[model samples]
Every structure is written in structure tokens, then in C-alpha cells.
Target chain A: MTERIVVSPGDLLGDGVFETLHLRPSGPWLLEEHLARLVRSSSILEMPEPPVDRIRSAISDLSVSSGALRVIYTRSGVLNVSVSTIPATVLRERREGVRVLTADLGFTVRKPPPWSLSAAKSLSYASNFAARRWAARQGADDVVWLSTEGYVLEAPTASVVWLDGGVLCTVPPEEAGILPGITAEHLLSLAGPAGLGAAQRMITGAELSRAGAIWLTSSLRGLAEVVELDGVARDRSPWTPRLLDLLGF
Target chain B: MTERIVVSPGDLLGDGVFETLHLRPSGPWLLEEHLARLVRSSSILEMPEPPVDRIRSAISDLSVSSGALRVIYTRSGVLNVSVSTIPATVLRERREGVRVLTADLGFTVRKPPPWSLSAAKSLSYASNFAARRWAARQGADDVVWLSTEGYVLEAPTASVVWLDGGVLCTVPPEEAGILPGITAEHLLSLAGPAGLGAAQRMITGAELSRAGAIWLTSSLRGLAEVVELDGVARDRSPWTPRLLDLLGF
Candidate 1:
């Protein structure tokens, strides 16, 4: 059933922060990290601190075995938590990988505006959705945004991760001025235990094309491998399953 | 009492478009242009055409003499019309002039991304709200954004207009890739009758400081003269009252 909430007009203006989690039979995956990021995003938007205790209580009361859970907090002090079944498309992307296109985002990482919300997971996701639609129109499943200077930034909804030699690398969040991807950070943190080196470095799009493998990481999708980059088909990497297992996805 | 609507969680994501108009005793100001722009904005976002006839009916049914009327349509096909008292600050800014600041938006007009919604008034207004808050923090009343190339762009909630001797000027919407301001365009259309010429041209931030007069134009505010720019106080322009009367405010 679709969940609904009563909201004032101001609440619909997208002046809010949200977190989507992969709710598993065990619990909402990375609950603490996602909540932490939610608070951080609110701070960035200058919203009042979120009601974490009430949010914890709400999450604990849910009986669903597994699904996608979303926590939203608006500037008008509206808080809502809803859970829905994971989309078939998301699951397909996880299993079969995604055909990706690289496009210039028309933003420079060198100097974002003082009030830039690029680093926050704000509710204003129309552009993100539009970019994906543009990719689909070009016969690709998703897009990786490139800065005007030709540096790889990230996918609209995911962090760009690539394997360079024995290292598992994602873009440095602070340096790139992007939302810190919890899944990518967790994977990189576990790289040593899995016998791999982890690093966060800025990579050019051209250099990224030559990486051993690439993946787009997020909370629910975990990691969707880049099956094809700018129309060139890539050989399936054996590390795909190993990395998925390492993350216990 | 605050009005409310029951909406699905998706409705709050800012994947929508909206228009605000001055609801006057004479009826909603510039109703036709706003509705047309609403449709154009919907097209830009790739959303379905809005239910125009229904919207017309909604407006016709409103009996409140005056206020701010907002029409909002989401990607999920939800349409809402609401009216509320104009804020005291808006009236104050209209009667008095505003202290303005110029900030680099860090976006180049040379090449906006293919999926750019900068020209559309999307509900993803968190960034716009943030910019205003940033301006307020800097001891300014409002902001006029400049492209990375130093070309003056629009303000967060209004369009920038200026007078160069006898010609009234504003940034061309198409060339600047910004939203077309109904109030500014209407004012420019009537400029000749008011014994002033009008033009749409690109002006740099530096050049703007020397203009005879400047104002931020919008539906509700009509025009707020720029009494100050970047910490320097500007003398009150005699044209301020004349322009306000010309707009029938």
C-alpha cells in the first residue's frame, strides 16, 4: 500500500533532506551511517536538527522483513518514514550491470557556490532524474557525470568506484564536493580485510575508461558494475561477486 | 488556517514545477503569462501537460480579494492551488529598496548541460532558498547571481532589471538560459509608452554598478529598487515609483 502524509504547501518545496536504506531481514542496513548523513545533510541545508530518537523508534517499530526504507525531514518540521518494495529495475541493474554514458555536468569542482547543495542529499532530485532520462534516451541505462575540466565526478545517484591495479578507489567526497556515499566508503574500509588496497583519488574520465573495472555504489543497489562505458563492452570481472560478498550484500 | 494536502512520499521530492502570482482585487495578476510559463516549465521537466482548464476553474473560484497565489504541479500529476497573505517582508522590500549582492553561481552560460532545468522554475528550490539565506547572512536583502563568465543573471526569486540612460534592460532569458520573468518582460513591453526604450542584453556585474537605476522584478513585489550593491549604497531612483505605477502595483 502506498503511504501518504498531510503536508503544507511549504513542505512540498523540496527544502528537505532524505535517506534511503536497504532494509534487510536483519535490519535497515547501515542505519547509523545513513542517519548520520541525514543529520549532516540537514545541517548543510540549515534545517533544524532531525528528531533522531523518534526516527529510531519509528524504524524499530516496523515489521517488514526487507525492502527499501526512506526517512524524510522537511524544513517545516515534517518527518515521515515509509517503506516500499525494491523496484525490479534496481535488482536487474544489480545482477546484470548497467550500460553507462559519460556527460559533462557543466559544473566545476574547483569552485562551487557558497550556498551549493551538491554535497547534500537534498530532496531536489529533478535534475538527477532528468540526467537518467537523458541517458535512457541515448540508449544507456545510467550516466556518470564529468566536470567541465574532464574529471569524473559521480553518477547522478551513485558513487563512481573503479579498480586500479589492486586498489579499490572512489572519488574523495570532500574534494569532489559530492555526497559521501556510505556503501562506497564501507567497501573501501573493508578492502584491506579482503586483501585489497583502498584509496580515494580524483580520476579523469579518460583514465577511468582504462580501469580494470568500474562500479556505481549506493545504499540499496550496493554496487552495479559498469557493463559498458560509452558504448564499449567490458569483459565481466571475476571480482564482482567477491566484492558483493565482501560487503555481505 | 494553513491548508493541507494528502500526498504520497514521492510528491515531496521537488520533482515538480510551480508559479507564484500576485492575487489582486483585479484578479490574479498576469494570469495568462504565468500559466503559459507553467506549461513551458512542465515541458522542460518532461512532465505531462498540466490540466489547464481545471487550473482556470480553480482560479476563477477563488474569492479572496488579494494575496499570493501559487500553482504547483508535481511529476506524479498532483495539482494544487493555494492563496495566502503576502508576507510583510515582500511588502517592505517593495515600498523600500533592497540591498543586493552579486555572487558567482559557478555555472557557465557557454554550455549548460543537455538536461539543464535552470530555465524552469522547478520545485527543487532548496538551492534558491539557500542562496537567499546566504545573502541575508552577508547583510544583504537579496542577491543577483552572475555566471562564471561574469555575465549578470537572475536573482533567486526575481529578475534583474536596470536602466542604461533611457533604455530599460534585462538579461535575455534564452541567451542566459534562465527563467523568463513575466513581470520584467511585461515592464519592458510597456517601456516605450512610459517614454523609455527597452532591450534585452548581457551585462557584466561591473557594468551593472554604473546603471542609472536597478530593480528586482517579480509578480508580488512588482519591483524592488536596488538601494545598495556589494556594500556600496545606491541613491534612490525617481523611476522606482513610476515603474511601480506602470506595473499597476
Candidate 2:
């Protein structure tokens, strides 16, 4: 499907917005939430918000019950939607969990530049992809980024979340100055009813490793439980499947 | 021409490389120099060097002169060369001059990140363009960026050069960890024979503003003389046109 979208040669500069959804037999899961984020993302880049109707029209077809869904919006004024095979790495992580490492990203902690689209899911995702590739090369399944100040940030392609005793937690977007993770937000919203509490707070990487059960959450992967952090291995927590079912995965 | 390319939609993500040459009646001015920069840029993004012959074939009916020539290369595997009308403001600056402001960009003096592409002219150019847009929004013609330690860095899209008495000087790319400015390098090379000394040294913005004449140099604009530093107006120097002509603008 990535090859199917016809576009201009200039569209590949990574100056675009994109959303990845987990396609379920029911439909593109969390479709509205993802679409809303796309619109918000576009606005941050000073791009015109894409009409939601057009997005709906593009993905209205009935087909694959399960796959990875992607919507890309470019500064050159192109919006495209597509579906493809779900990555095997995502499936493996969902099942067996993952080993993770942490590193400082060293970005400006002050106000982002006037044109900063840090909150946008822009297609300029080469660095994100490269970070993941670097993690793979280092024998870790994923990486959790830190600010130069040593405050924990998000994962390259997912949000960092943890079960701090009974309180489920994720970082605050405004304070962290990161793209708000839709899947993590949805999960946090559901925490209260799941007999747990949820909070948004900044934590250091060391604090994260000591949490009850750490996971990287995203639309496609849903949740990849961390079985080993840094180097110490741990047994899988029993809550992984329960949370997936709650999310209707 | 933007509409003519047979590109897949994924091409728009800002994850690419580009070369902007000063197009002249004699074909692209400094074509070899620009191609070498393109190759250096490709290595920064971990992409394969594109086939130069393919790029050469695209420049067939080379009929245009005195324009801005840009060649875009995307990780999605598309090589696009385009020639367009240069911005009138650029020409105006060549004829007149520019009011310049300096600000600290907060980049550390330490080595760039392992994955940093700061030295490359990769297509993740939204920030570079945004900085210029920011300057325009602030009512200045352009901005000269400074490092976190207050060392004078390059401009958003050009190299910063100043005349200290009879010596012509600019920041050394290797020492400053910046994208080497092709125009500035060429100008500095000819400075000695022209009876002006040439040097590369790290200087503060205050030191630059105190210099006799200040200018921003790039391939397209050649040299944009600084008519004002900060809020203080300065007279246009006689060397602006001489240097532009020397570079064959």
C-alpha cells in the first residue's frame, strides 16, 4: 500500500504528518482518535488541517481485519492513507515482551522554535526510524529517550508508560514538549475503571526501570511489555494480556 | 514542474538530501562542488550515493540561466532536479543590502550526536526554512545563529563572514561543526590574492558586529551585505558587488 499512493517527487522530504493505527476485524481501531491527532499535528506544522471527511472516505473500504494503518500529510499539501502487513517485531514484543535501553536525546529544553512541530506526527521520521534501527543494532528491542537534563522522555515510536503500584502513569505532553501519544492517553483514561489510578508525571530512566511493569505503548503495537531493562531480566507480568483485552485488541 | 514527477506519496517526509546550485547561462555554476556536498550529505543520512549519471540525464534541455537550481534526493529512492525563479528578495539584497539580527541558537560546543546530520544538507529542511520564516516574521531580512556558548555560528541558510580591517574571515566548518558554505569558501580562497587576508576563527556575535563589514554568503545569493547590525544602521561597503562578480553571479 505504501507503493500505491501516487505523489510528487518532493513529497519524501519527511515534512509531513502520519498516523499509525492498529487495524482490527471491527475496523481501523481508534480511528477517530487517530484522525483527530492528525488534524492537530498538521496545525502544529502551520499546515492546513486536513478535512476529516476525506480521511474517512479514503479508509471506508471493508477489507483486512488486521493490519497496520498509516495516514501521511505533507507540507506540499498531500494527504494519503494506506494499510500494510503488521510488523513481526510488533507481534513478537506483544507476545514475549522486550528488552530496552535508555539514552539522552539532547534537544533544547527551552521553548521550541516558533515553527517547531514537535507535537506533530510529521513524516520527517527518519530520526525516529534511525533511533529504532540503532536500538536493534545494539541488541535492544527499543530505546527510551531522555532529555539532556536526565528527565525521561518518550520512546522513538511509542509512549513510555508504567504501572507504579496501582497508579498507571505516562508523561505530560505540555511539560515534556512531545507528541501526545494517542494509545497511551486512551489507556490512561481507561485505568480508573480497570481498578487502577493514572497520573502524568516526569520520571527519570532509573525510576522507570523500577516501576512495577514498564511498557512502550502505541496504536500499532498496543503495548510492548519490558521483560528486561538495561541488562537485568525479569519474568513477564500477568497484566499484559489483560490490558490488551481491555483495549479490545 | 512539481506536479510532473512520478513520486510515490511517501516521498514528502523531510527525510532527504538536496543541492541548491547558482544556475548560470554556462550551466549550473560549481556543479562538481554541489555534487560533492550531496554525496557528503547522503553519508550523514546513511543513504546510498545516487547515480550521478541519472542526475546528469535529467538536465537535458538546459535553457535557463540566472536561476536557483535545486536537486532533491529522498530516502524513498527518488532523485529530482528542479530549476526555479530565484526569490526577488535575494536579488534585491544583492543590489541593496540586509538588516541582520543575531541570536543564540543554544547548540552545544561539544561534538554532534552520533546520529546528528547537522553538517549535511539533508531535506529535513523545514527547520532551516522555518528559521528564515521566523526572521521574516520578526521584520528582519535574516538571522545569524550563535552557539549555546555564545560563539557566532552560521546564518540560517548562509555562512556568516565579516571583514576585520583588510582580512576576510568566516567560521571554519570543521571547528564550528557546521555545514561548509561553498560560496564563503570560494570567496575566502580568492581573498589572499585580492590583497585581503583570509582566516577561519570562532568569534562572538558582538565581535562580528564590530567588524568593518559583515555579509552572509550562499550559492544563490552570492553575498548579502549587512546594511545594519542589530538596530544600528551601517553603510553598504564597496566590496559587495566586487565579490559577487568575482564569484560570477
Among all candidates shown, the one with the greatest lDDT: 1
What's the distance in Å from true for residue B152, model 2? 3.0
lDDT, candidate 2, at A61? 63
DockQ of each: 0.90, 0.49
Writing each residue's lDDT as its tens digit, candidate 1 over A1-249 gives 989899998888999999999999989999999999999999999999999999999999987868999999999999999899999989999899999999899888988999999999999999999999999999999999998888899899899999999999999989988999999999999999889899999999999999999999998889999999999999888888898888777
The list of candidate 1 runs beyond 4 A from truth reads: none
The residue-by-residue lDDT of candidate 1 on B62-140, one tens digit each, is 8686999999999998899999999999999999989999999988899999999999999999999999999999999
Per-candidate iRMSD: 0.6, 2.6
Per-candidate local distance difference test: 0.94, 0.80
Looking at model 1, residue A186 earns an lDDT score of 95
Candidate 1 C-alpha error for residue A96, in Å: 0.8
